[model samples]
Target chain A: MANLPIKTVGVIGTGVIGASWTALFLAKGLQVIVADPAPGAQDKLRSYLEKEWPMMSKVGLGPGASLGNYKFVADINDHLGQVDLVQENGPERLEFKRGLFANLDAKTRDHVILASSSSGLPSSEFVTDCKKNPARVLIGHPFNPPHLVPLVEVVPHPGTGSEYVTAAMEFYRKLGKDPVLVKQEVPGFIANRLQAAVCSEAYSLISRGIISAQDLDKTMTSGVGLRWAFTGPIMTNVLGGGGNFRHMVEHLGPASKVWTEDMRKHEFDASNPQSLNELSNGVEEWVSNIDLESLEKKRDNSMLGLIQEKSKDAA
Target chain B: MANLPIKTVGVIGTGVIGASWTALFLAKGLQVIVADPAPGAQDKLRSYLEKEWPMMSKVGLGPGASLGNYKFVADINDHLGQVDLVQENGPERLEFKRGLFANLDAKTRDHVILASSSSGLPSSEFVTDCKKNPARVLIGHPFNPPHLVPLVEVVPHPGTGSEYVTAAMEFYRKLGKDPVLVKQEVPGFIANRLQAAVCSEAYSLISRGIISAQDLDKTMTSGVGLRWAFTGPIMTNVLGGGGNFRHMVEHLGPASKVWTEDMRKHEFDASNPQSLNELSNGVEEWVSNIDLESLEKKRDNSMLGLIQEKSKDAA
Candidate 1:
């Protein structure tokens, strides 16, 4: 086992999420050794890292951090010797992930902790059967780009030790991220389920002649949405009925019933596609740039400004 | 049914919400007459309007439009003479509301649409039996201070006529406010139910040793919250896990089990008045001088800056 301090973290893929993760680690002064078989992956990640690192540093995160420490390789096994942690951003294919874990088990000595960036597939399915040290295998799901969005769901299988989970949490925290531990493996985790529930209602409203998508968006952005940025849904309800969610439950229950009668299912009708297209175009115009760098920079700058301005007064 | 281009709105109470509604109406350049029994409410509202009016002008929303048309009153009936719409903001007591609706119905002969700002109870229970013109009574719920945040939930009871609902909707729309027809009444309407669901989960996390409340707040603010301000919850999910929400759904469906299992029936346990005192004190310090005037002024400056920035982009 290698005993050098973990200044460098290795990455397995160089797609949007992988590169984003690289930028985050590199920005925090961690040397990132990224290995991706895809052609020109290193060049693409380098460019993304250069732009996003500066923006992230502008917001008061971990000081003395940037993309200067990032080094990329075309071979996977070459990274196993050096990394303190290995965050795999491989294709979401079960067989492919299984193969990677199998190879990693043979190549790496018993030092590096292997974390897969999978949102859906439980860590057990991907790593348990292959690796000799499957206990180190865990899921580290980031929200889009790792640099800007700070929520990372650290999920582990039953055999996974608590020590590894603790270490993983600390690692993410050091990077100035909000790492939420998933007690058990489940689909979508915490944020996604809540999002789906909201999306389901939003889509149903449009399908049931309740309101247009733009109006639905406006209803959120202008009304409940602003307060929600400061407080979670439950806290809003607490203040909503004057510090009594029970009162809200007692009152709004009828309206929910009125809606359940017409709850739209999963089938996407013809109108939905057209509406989605219209919405997509509108979103593109608003967001403008589709690249990872621009999106990350925009999120970082705006987020910092908002936090400085509003966070001071929020409960 | 005296109808001569119903141009003005009468506000019943001049509390925070009532004042905000007046600000919104006046900002839209419509005539507004405000009445409240509370001492100094008239002066406070005027100060609020004066500060907010210029901001509205700075945002290119118009100047004289919001300022010249406001009238304050000590008696409710005085404002009812020329107003075409009435926004009720009485105390949260059902009896008090029933009594007020009775008076409002008898006081004016104008085809004025009456709407309540109740967070929970539908106008149906409050006005189903009391009004001579029962069709005029509906619910118009706004997030606090309607001037800045602009979505209004326009909910009409079964007894309420479509003409009143349509007219009320058009009125809000004409004010450049987003009005959503709830289609049917639900407890907490559309916004607070969603809020409750999120809060329940968040509170559970805090109570359960899974994470600290402050950390959760930071997580939301840093991770999900920033994206929410620009992209919103649904769009964030669409961008979060690869492409549209399908992949996220597939992965998250299982992960949701942990949340629901942990979410539990969380009662807002304010038993520890210590925490409450501390949090309140913190918010107070941050907002020691944040009266309606200051809030309006801040909103105006931001909106003005936002408009100018956007206009520059357009140019």
Candidate 2:
């Protein structure tokens, strides 16, 4: 498939991630067609759009963007040949994904790239049954609340054509998203794996009583998080090296080894009642009383301001 | 120390960290006495003060705060019996710190607490030689650019008094800083260790050519970084749990384990030419062309804005 400029996007699921994708696509002035079988899915999607439109406007919508330029269908077949690309946010079960992709493959055009927002499962695990055109299928997983967050991890399977990967990446970039091509299809990809590494240690620390959840959160929100907001660990490491990342490795590598070696692994079984209660109680000590909706609004507003600030010099 | 309100702060060694502390001290309306023997150190400190004053002003200076309230001395003896507390940012050499702290301990009043801005070395490593009032000495290590970043890891040695730790925490909190009392004196402390955990995996991925430094950075700066800027991984994990952290751990814990098991460890030896070249080239590809000064300004400005936003509802 050629690297076609995506003008219309079909959203295969209209839950949180799907609704977010809809908002972003609409903000970017792309025609969006959405389909979901759940009752009131369309109403929920419309409500989400209305609530998020003001924030989207402040974040700066693309030229000619309009909330009215969208279509929602109860049948997946309605999206056939209607969208240039399709974002599948269906249930994460492999069997469900396979069935959906098979039907989508038969229905959509051969060139219409089919991307799944599977966070952990690689596209190959689900796209195996897309006999008609597996080359156009891949994972274009966005971080949660995709409309606001810019990262889209585009992981293509071995059978996926290079052109399709490029097309999906270019499409996300056109929507003012930061699209990273996952060179290898590891489970959870890069972000979640990295998050797991840090979080495992965080869990161990909390469980061992070395620190409180509030302090751990403060350590990041006030300390390294500021740096990570703009520069990743690698770039920060480079600067830590005086612009030579190797120097940092030489000096800090042993220290890193020591920490990583001392790092603890935490495994909490869902079926274990004791472990669940302990973890739940600990979280309550820190954030149980927080008004989550208000906090989310604050977070979203702050994120919007920061995003606008970063995009100031963009061409 | 009875959590004595710190009024005058003596800053030893005026490098970037010391200068930043000086700026923050002045901004907080504390009388600052700085001592550094290096030639042109005073000029650099003055320049840093002048350069940072506007930003600090924007960040909000306390009543009676002024650059004029600061005094510079070439001799450490000048700070004797002069300031209520001391923040040492001396060279990261054990012998130098030992000798300097011994003199500082003997010269300053026993009631005054001494806090070192050492990034990795614990207070026990150097305070052993302080003959007088070593119990008042501890590490109050700040993140880079101490004035801008709010986190200060207050680590105390075994011999240090609990009251001194409490005093130090109270002092930093009074300055509008986030003081996390590190119960253990481990190398690199919590934030850096957590950072090392993530960076270790990042390095292995880059070294193995699974991903480029740029995409790896985008994965954080665009995805997890946003969450981290407001909520640390622990709180984020708790939120991920549907307000029941245990639930998240139960459901996502297995997934985290899978990722952690797949994680790789990296140790880069500076003497290894291949390691140095590989790491350096990877970072250069991402950040080589960017103007460092302007980039730093952008980062600092964004940080200032975010800090202000976060502080809006503070009691």
Candidate 3:
């Protein structure tokens, strides 16, 4: 954060997440060299970044001169020597990711930290046996849009060193993200696990006819979501149960019993690939039917204005 | 809601919730006649209104110019004949709430709806008999601040007419709230029940050394909380698992089974009141060591700004 020395960042893939990663790194005033073998990847990254940069700058997340910091290459060898960090945003296949990391570790300098933008996969799963110095390799998972949400889950593999963890956290902090260290290698880490917990309940509620998806969204947006944004669930309870969060734990033995007995678990088997076909079709349906992209765009503008209002109030 | 007459609202109690009720009604430009023999209850309600109104208006929830709609009477019989609605924010004791509802329902007009804001006890436990218009009574429960968060849980008693349910829902909708009607009486209704489910996990996390309360709050504020403010859990899952929410459910079931087994429940006993005493004292200790009133003021400002931002976004 104190006059960061990062001038350029190397991106290993140019898929959706990869392009987002490229845009994010570039937005922070760092030249981003996105290396991907996919045929139209570079052009896609270019178009996406060009379309997104102005909006990002409007939110004060990027400088208007963002395009100057972007570069796309079909080869990692072309960019590795000059960059400070290499971000891997490749396919979910372990073999592909592992091979990518191995090449990245071998090609990049010892001082450069290698980070991945994977949501669920642990760093150890793919980065193992990558180099003589696994000390510099770690997972720096960003939510969908790294430049916006301001959260990065930093997980260090067993072989990864403390210096790398510290550096990665500091690196993300420089980009205005609030990164939390994963003490151990959990399946989904902290955010997604809590997310899964809530999602389990949502699916159960929908499946049980207790509430529909839209009503559930409203229950949160109106009822619970308001508090969770500024404060977490525990603090919500603290203020909600009249300044004592433990009151729920202390008294509601019976209710707790019911929750445990009926609680649903989240799994990722993906048996009904058709369900995703249905869901993706649903997203397209939702988008075409309600003009969701416009809703998102409107929401972003509103959020940007709000963030400005908040900053001014704080001042 | 349609600029219909809100001449006098019968307020059936004058404790903390009742006082808050008085302020909220007055803020909404409603005449309220409060009934309470408890010393200083009327004065306290007035004092709270005077202090809270300016700030509330600054945050955009007050009809400040119309603040003349508040009245406190010594007798419950004073304004029953004229008021359009009766809000019973009385003691949580089943007998107390039941007796008040009976009195309010019997004495009030047939058109007026009687509502309680109890978080725990079900409406049916107290409002089963004696009211000539039983259908007019239900629970219109709110969180700590009924005026701010804008979630009203409307729960109708079994004997309550279906017509009143629609009326209550319509009323809240008019007030610009996202109100959900609990089809059948449940102990905590929807919001508190969802809250209890999450609280159980947070407590269990604390007990298991998974994270501290501070860290857990951070985990929420930085991660899950951000998405939650934008999308509900179901939609978050749909986005989380790479647009494959159902896929995550199917694949991760085995991993989730352990979570169900590991659910933690805390038990409380009233005879040994040390725990409750400890809780109260701990809060006292924490507050005494800090500028809690100023802290609350600071929180109010922050919350005000955030709510303003969200409302603007919604608009």
Candidate 4:
């Protein structure tokens, strides 16, 4: 089963993530069977693909890839058996996921892999509802704008089969995605936890009036973010240590400890209304004068160019 | 003083940071007076510039920029009076900075801005030694490899004058550097604190055996790092919330709080030898089969390409 080719993909719930996944699957020349209950979701997905197709082409499309390669269904249950794998992107609520996965389990073949695009909830929370082949269910979470970005966190539950994990990893890798096998189920997984860590510190700095939102963002885009885009913090630590990880840890670890201690004193508290207001207002002031639509377009275009630039490297 | 155009720069120390600063200054078409006491320091600085000149040229050189525009002096104090702005990258020691800055304060003209590229210590920590015109002394901390990276944290001590702050900002901006004025001196300033936050979380994940060091780095370079390269976290939250930052905070903030709390439990304690070993060994295993020299070259080249791609955007 691990070596079986996944020629068709079932994408349930064609929201933002789902649509992006659909676009990627189509670009990979796979027949994507999409389902969504929301009104106009089909049109929205089509429009999104139309807007994103050129960028996808620039990134290089798969053999036989086409915009008309997918079929939309109002009920995913009707076409569940046709797909080699299932990508569930229903609402993030646990109850919704529990019901959706259970239905998916009942309809799909036992050999079919069931993956969720949940950013927060672990697959274990909902997989228990699947009466058959729960071992195949796992999390295949991608960063936002999945078609453009390459990261896919392939997280498996404790009881998830090793073979299915391999299949999921191979499937995503074959599609040109960088998939990491998460060994444990942690809240927010790896990427989001890392993102939250940065955001928490950023929010703290802004709330303390130490720096404005714009400057904080500039600090990233112009500084660490540029480095992180090419190197992870661990490898960065290794390189910073002059090609010896121990040297870096011994030299810079103490200062980092002090920074972390200072950072812990000001965690972003969602419960505090004032904290939320301050952060919201800070971002508002930063984006108030700018046209968000054009800014977003520019961001997407820049990301596309960066992806091209990065691909030139052997990594 | 704010309106004064800086034609000459005094660069103290010729280590990695100092050399990079010298390269940037020369590339900016400024006559640079560099001083370092280390043996063969002048040769090392010239070699570093020779190797990095091509990348800087690709990023675009300032008018009249030349490799021979710099003069290396054995003692910075001798030519401190010749420069309009002094960028100090001396050893990171309190006593060293105190003594160096005191000499800088006494030798340089009262109007010349004395800027230290110190990463850990604040400007105030050493400025007390500058009895004459301490207001001209401040921290102009740049991220590593300052010649390529754009961020420079322009932090001022309480006694530092606003005109110098304005001068520092204007001077760095003129050289195509993104200078963020840190309103208050905080531990790790802005960029390092944010970086430490992400590193701490990354260390925890790797130490806990939840992910490999390579995957953790891949998670960043392939995921959030891509988005961060273009948009900062605050604006990212704003866009994530559908153009309303308040909405994003209210929605994702709770989950982020949970992640932060979990992250706090596993702070990277430098005192723990076992913890340091775990992180160091993890990174070692990841890089064991890779070539460090080529990787560094690849990273620097990729960064240069990214900078060029980013410069196209209006921001």
Candidate 5:
């Protein structure tokens, strides 16, 4: 079967991620059908879209793109017949997702791609309950503020058709997103796990009193972060070693190994009160003087400028 | 003794790092005396300073700052008496560093701070041979393109004076550099270790064919890296969980642990021809159609713009 063209996208659960996804799809000239059970989801989503549309326009908007092209419904089933694709952003509970997928599978067209925005859960876990054609089910997780951040992790279940995966990747690419394929199901997918590795080590260092949270953030914002904003770790290694990653490894391997061996491993047990207190106390102390909203605004503006600068002279 | 102000900076070994340091110091209105033994080193250093001066001026130049304020010499001993601080960027070998530190110890003023630009070698390893006040010697490692990148890792040997460490930190701060004080003498320091952790995971994913190098780069440049450029992993976690880092850990800890345990460790051995070939081929293939030079230019320009934007509302 040919891949379905995604001109109208169904967004289930109009929360932050879903709303942002809706805004992005709209900016790409796609009509978005938003479904959420919350009492004021329509108002919330409308305000969000209005707030983000200017920024999206500055970034770029497809021909005839406008917020008026979207529709809001309290029921997902009502919009299933209208959208060519469904983006599920329901609660992360497996049971809830499983039940939702089954209902979505029953109502949506057989060829419509049903993509869950779950961060870590594999689609295979939920699709097993679906009685209808389950080959169209997969995970298309986006980073936060999906309209701005360009990553969309396209993860496919083992039972998912290869063509659907390709189609999903193409769809996201058409929306100006970089979609990375998750060949195998891994917990937290790729980005989250990588983030965890760094986070765990950071927690350990802070707990041990080696550095303050402000300094740690400064360490990144001024150093590794600069390198990462343009390239990945592997390419940075290649550049570090003068176009040879192996050379870098050979020269700096022992030091890196020692550090890795000493890296802290934090077990995230919810029952542990100390861990939570420690992290919270640290963060509050670090942000004592700075207002979070302004800091975040500064960050967003900088990201916007960076994206604009990098896209210039694009081939 | 009070910390001596740094009006003159001596740059040893006028290579890329040294030349960059010279450009930065000169832009900050510090008279820099660059010393290198290599033939035509003066001409090369002069050319580099000339090319970077315009960009440096755009960023900001202190009063009386000019490229002509810098001088070049073929002997380190000649500039020791003239500079208040010496930034060594010699070859990264313990034997050579030991020799250089000893010479610098004997030639420099008793109050002068002798700092190394070594990326991995801790100052303690080489400063042991500095008979005259080894406490004054430490590591002042800068990220690449010292004139542009803001991070400078200031690492102190245990025997180094507490005052010297504080002075070094303040000095770098005055020059508009984010100097992170490495609490302990850890190899690879904080930034590089974090980078290594991420690199190891990325290499593992690529080797397993989960994602291509190009897509991996995109994943970072578009996702995690965007957050990181503004904040560290720890702060990001705190924000991720709505001002609670611990909440994030409790929810995502198990998945993160699984990924960390499964992370790959690549040992860089020059004798291992296979590792070199594999990585080189991978990078070349990812960069096949794209020109590396243009890519790098785009990165640098984006970085400059990001820096400009971030510094606007600086408190």
Candidate 6:
């Protein structure tokens, strides 16, 4: 295992996720080399960074962090040797990823860690094409707008090097990111699966006319979401049982079965046209009365405040 | 349809939920007549109030709110006629709730809104025993520690009066609570059903050794939970589509189905002894190292901070 510190990061494909990653890397005092063949990608990334910098500054920038520290490279392959680590946010096509990883594997040094920000695709599927040191490549998926939200799922395939896994976890931790190592290659990893679980039930309820989209959102923000912001469901259960896990399961188990049984009957499926239309229409009506741009701003601001509050508690 | 404000509340069964309701009522400047037949229930409730009062004060108490305005009564029946509303927090047994609601129905005036704090049992299940004015009885379920959390599920049965629903919604809204009217009586209501969905997936993942309990919690607290704290799943989907709900569904539909299909296969079933044991043991191991009391205190404090911050944004 190479013990070199990651001082420079290569960001591939400057989409929303990649741009956010670049902004975060820049804020953390790391030199970022960004590359995207798409027209105006550099300008868009710069604009996004400029717009998001104030909030990042409020969260406190790292030592020597600067807006001008990053360079927009024409080709990431040419700059691969200059970066200590690479974060790929390319398109989700399996063939595209396979070819990209193969190229990345050949260009980057064996010591350099290559991480993908793919939300769904696992590294193992694409790494089959990487002939050189595929062991160092893994999924470092972040929640949307990685610059703000702290979750990064550091999922390593069965063949991934344990040292690289540790390095990835430590790398994110040093950047003020909460990185969870998903033990096995699972679809959706941890956060998205949990999110899908909740969303399915939510869609089911909405489709069945048990609740409106607006009211369902209220149910979360006002109640469970408030507690969940700091504590996850399992710990929440533990707390609900008054710090006893056994007691909680024993008390709430039967009720949970009933709810899950009802929930299992429905899911948010695109194949089911009526179900999809019902949920989409409900959300459409809800958003019709909402100024989404302003709401997004408010949500980001609130998220910043919450992250700060939580970090203070952690400290 | 009496237009009288809910000035005074009768609190029956001052256990955890009931006591929390009393604290909120007292903080909202409502006269509370609390009754519990259990030994030392009054002292427990008093201590709980004293401990939680500081947080409530931090969230900014309602007009004329005071800790001393509530009276612990030996019998809530005598005071039911004096109170404008009755918030029952009795045992979960259907027979017990039926008898309690029957007595409350007989004693309280027709205009008095009787709301049960039951988490699972729907009002319709027990309202069959209410001989008089069963229309006024409904579920006013709050998330645990109702004094801090803003969500109140104002669920009314099919037979419940429309006036009572309006009154309950207005009453909670006046107290700065976010109450969502549950249009239909469903088991576990809205929040718990959503909660159960998430927990089932969480339990399944833990049991399958896909992730540790600790990391699962981190995934939530750091990722989806943060967003959920303010915006919910459906609205999140809309935002993901860049303020277009249909776009989000269409774009992410295929992936979401894959996730939900995988998630639907496993559930946290109490009847399946191994599944139950695996989840319980995982949680047990995770909590063993955690100082739950201190964690609970930290969670509550952080929750108070987040709630205060969110309310500021809303303002």
Alpha carbon lDDT of residue A167, candidate 3? Answer: 83
What would the TM-scores of all predictions be?
Answer: 0.71, 0.93, 0.84, 0.97, 0.92, 0.97
Q: How accurate is candidate 4 locally (lDDT)?
A: 0.87
Better of 2 and 6 by TM-score: 6
Residue ranges of candidate 6 with Cα displaced over 4 Å: none
Model 5, A88: alpha-carbon shift in Å? 0.7
Q: Which tens-of-lDDT digit does each residue in B8-97 have in candidate 1?
A: 788899777888778777766778887888888778878877766665665446444647687787787765667778888878778888
Best by the DockQ measure: 4
lDDT per residue for candidate 1 within A25-68, as digits (tens), equals 87777888888888887788778777666666764445556556
- C-alpha root-mean-square deviation, each candidate: 7.0, 2.7, 5.0, 1.6, 2.8, 1.5
Model 6 lDDT at residue B123: 92
Better candidate number, 1 or 5, judged by TM-score: 5
- DockQ of the two-chain complex in candidate 3: 0.36
Local accuracy of candidate 6 as per-residue lDDT tens digits, A134-223:
999999999986888999999999999999999999999999999998999988998988888788788878887888999999999988
For candidate 4, the docking band is: high
Worst 10 residues of 3 chain A by lDDT: A263-272
Report the TM-score of candidate 4, chain B only: 0.96
Query: What is each predicted model's overall lDDT from 0 to 1?
Result: 0.64, 0.83, 0.67, 0.87, 0.80, 0.88
In candidate 3, what are the lDDT values of residues B2-80, reduced to their tens digit? 2345556788777767776676677666677888888887777778878888875774554543566777888878579
Model 5: how far residue B265 lies from native, Å: 9.3
Candidate 5 recovers what fraction of true contacts? 0.72
User: Can you list each candidate's DockQ?
Assistant: 0.22, 0.64, 0.36, 0.84, 0.60, 0.83
Query: Cα lDDT of model 6 overall?
Result: 0.88
